[model samples]
Target: MQQDTIEQRPDAAADWPDQIYDLLKLHNIRQVALVPDAGHSRLIKRCIADNTMKVVTLTTEEEGVAMMAGAWLGGDRSVLLMQSSGVGNCINMLTLSSIHRTPMPMIVTMRGDFGEFNPAQIAMGNATQAVLEAMGTLVKRADTPEDVAPTVDATLRMAFNTFRPTATLLGQRLLGAKTFGKD
Candidate 1:
């Protein structure tokens, strides 16, 4: 049944971002910190529109990581959204999560992999997962739209329940890889 929904139809993927937003609500995520990216526009907008959610637009990805630490300390559940290239910026702040065994749920929109077009995205995008894992973050990916909700749900549970940092990578398949002169 789960396989049928996840693997059978790409057409059903249209609402995956909404599904992720619903999961955030379900998880009682009260704070959202993000460095905006095109791939995350939908989710970011959803959170921003919600009055119950405290949404912070960050100057850098690392600030979001540190902010989550403060949020968790204050008994508020928080999530960070960033592009894969921003992952490098968060490495040091992730130590706060690691050292304190605090939950920091982050959603990353990937670049520089699969069908990536930008030359600069290649390096950090390729290294994102490795960097997160090195910081002891439980890393996972949602390669297709259908995978988004489930992947994010699991990461949220893993982070909140286990008190560990977790990241969900939204892959190019879902966001549509950026390419030259292609709409």
Candidate 2:
């Protein structure tokens, strides 16, 4: 497996997801568990393309929590990719990682903020960060394209290197606010 280093360039910020993929490769994160999400489409596609990573599609978000825990016990690094709405599903399962001191890193693409069109996405999305923090997971916010790479890098370090459960919330503003309808 080839490890790619993220270059510090002005245009690098535009490709934050790619930078994150590179960091994951650089750190040898071999397991990826996720609930399919449009917010994470690009990163998910990248993970699918990489032959070195084990990508698992989950039925529910909590399953990802359990998957990461198992992967860690097997001596492999793993990350969960989900949307903010999915956070509610993992609240109880999060205790497994927290109490057991398993390092689980989650990348959550936020909704119900900024230009969100669906009123249904509001409640859970607004509570995502608070819920994760309450469950003993360190939460980091990346509201800008420029902040994405650095926040992901730091979260990965804190989660894997320090054995801390961490969550990186990717704001909707950075992901281009979703529109209501299309012609």
Candidate 3:
């Protein structure tokens, strides 16, 4: 299959999520397991509106891990959407995906990296990539809006086609820095 590629630009970031949704459909990803997060709110909404995909809201990040593993075992392709903080919650459970060589692809919205408002989000946010790598999951970063679609496209191909656990970290800059309080 020929892979579609897009040019990255500052203004193009806003369109990346939509591009990601299109790629999801193109890849035939039927199940989506996610812990609701503002970072992924738009993509989540897109998935819910599409009847073709089964979108599962998870109680915890680890639950999404297990859900994707089960989906893969049952012969369905799935993806997990979560924030950087949730990555910590999935560390031990990630072993399940890694050990079985499950094709677990994740879209992780980064926090505590750039323009972070909450101090508590710092630790896990910073450790997200390293932790996933330690568990044998391939990690990719989309720091620019242009990088989003291509990164997701390639990661999806790598995860499902290559049968490798993978994650794409969407930088806070691309998602917009979270504001703590209303003015």
Candidate 4:
């Protein structure tokens, strides 16, 4: 199969995705929850193929939130991956982490902010950061190949240390805008 725009991004060659996967292992995160998004393809594949990790493919982003809650309750470290558009779906569910102080770590691949082709995607992507902040999520961003490891490592430390809901947004600048086939 051919790679998509996200996979062909220069950062992919730099292997920020691998750095993220390594950090996940370093943190001993045993569970990976996500819905399919091209920006996360490599990392998702890595987590799925790793026997030490249990990857949960969720139908919606909110389900990952609930599942992470359960995973933490069961004494396993977990993280969620989704696109900027999906953040809207988890608005209410994020309360689970905020009110209870659960360690919910999320990696969101941003869209609609840079070279976005789909006008529909621009709104949520534009609002994701502010909305997540309003909902009490500690949001960080990784906008370059060099930003991946440091941002993710720091977000993980923050989330696990204080049980705060944290997210590291893989910005459009980092993953490149999904320009599929437009001019």
Candidate 5:
């Protein structure tokens, strides 16, 4: 696919989560585990609503990781969707990612940056990138809606090809405050 072939303004097509679905479809990712966030609620809902993709809602981020790992071992491509704060919660399970050599891609919606007014999200938001990096993730930050599809596509391709985990930081700058928009 051409790198510049993406819509700039938000539409049904510019919906970040839908872009996720398109990328997964392109990658043949038949199953996925999701730890829903307001940031990803629409996308997760879309995944669950769509019959083409198998969606597993997880209680915690670690559960998502474990489930995706199992799917990968069974010869299916999978993705984990979660907010940045969940990264702190899933540290232990993250070790399994490296130990098993699971090359799944994680799409993380960053909080506590840019327009963030939440004091609670500060720790995880600040530490989010560092934590994932420490855990050996090849990270990329998408600062615009148009950037999301290609970044995710590239990250998934890189992770699968290298057999290493990859993370795409869905930065606050790109998404702004609200999760859903019709722009």
Candidate 6:
């Protein structure tokens, strides 16, 4: 049933950026911190150019972790965008959300699975799910656009309402390999 819905929409596999923006808008999320990666390049570009969202590019993924903490302190809802490799860098700080009781949503572009040509991505991608769960985050994988909007909305709500982190895994099938548009 779910497979049929995903197969019917080609955009479901590639329209994560727009769908994510729609979810954020629906949730009233306005600020974001990100560590750039090929998977999220289109989304990041759209965020940078979009007047509606305040996008901050960080030096490291952990910086994004800290930045979100700060954003929450300032009363702005936000999410961190990064790749699976970045997850390793952000692991230790995962407890920050637990300690602070803040649901800091993270929208992760995952690799290390099917259609992944990059050898470097495989390990991190495989460990991504376990790592997120181990750190006490509720993880949801959005392999298609049809799944993205609802999953993101739910993740955000979980993070905020439950006061725990929620991670949405945007799989490679959704983002593709080639970085689209600008350099």
Report lDDT (CA) for all predictions. Answer: 0.83, 0.82, 0.82, 0.85, 0.77, 0.77
lDDT of 4 by residue, 1-183 (tens): 122243323333458889999999999999999997878877988999999999988899999999989999999999999999999999999889977789999999888767776678889999999999998889999988889999999889999999978999988777753344421
Give the Cα error of residue 20 in candidate 2, in Å.
1.2
Across 122-159, the per-residue lDDT of candidate 6 in tens digits comes to 78888998998999989999876678888888899998
| Residue pairs clashing, model 5 | 10-183
Candidate 2, 75: how far from true, in Å? 0.5
TM-score of 6: 0.85
Worst 10 residues of 3 by lDDT: 1-10
Compared with the true structure, what per-residue lDDT tens digits does model 2 show for residues 11-62? 2225778888998998799999999776677688899999999999999999
Error of 5 at 87 (Å): 1.0
User: What's the CA error at residue 49 for candidate 2, in Å?
Assistant: 0.8
Q: Model 4 scores what on Cα lDDT?
A: 0.85
Best-performing candidate as measured by lDDT: 4
Report the number of clashing residue pairs per model.
0, 0, 1, 0, 1, 1
Question: What would the TM-score be for candidate 1 when compared with the true structure?
Answer: 0.89
Report clash pairs, candidate 4. none
Poorly placed runs, candidate 4 (over 4 Å)? 1-12, 177-183
TM-score of each: 0.89, 0.88, 0.88, 0.90, 0.86, 0.85
lDDT of each residue in 73-128, candidate 5, tens digit only: 89888888888888888777878779988886899888765556667877888998
Residue-by-residue lDDT tens digits, candidate 1, 1-183: 221121111232367767888999999999999998867776787898999999999999999999999998999999999888899999999999879999999998887766555677789989999999999999999987668888999999999999989999988666653333222
Which structure is stronger by lDDT: 3 or 6?
A: 3
Candidate 2 residue 175 Cα shift, in angstroms, is 0.3
Using TM-score as the yardstick, the better of models 3 and 4 is: 4
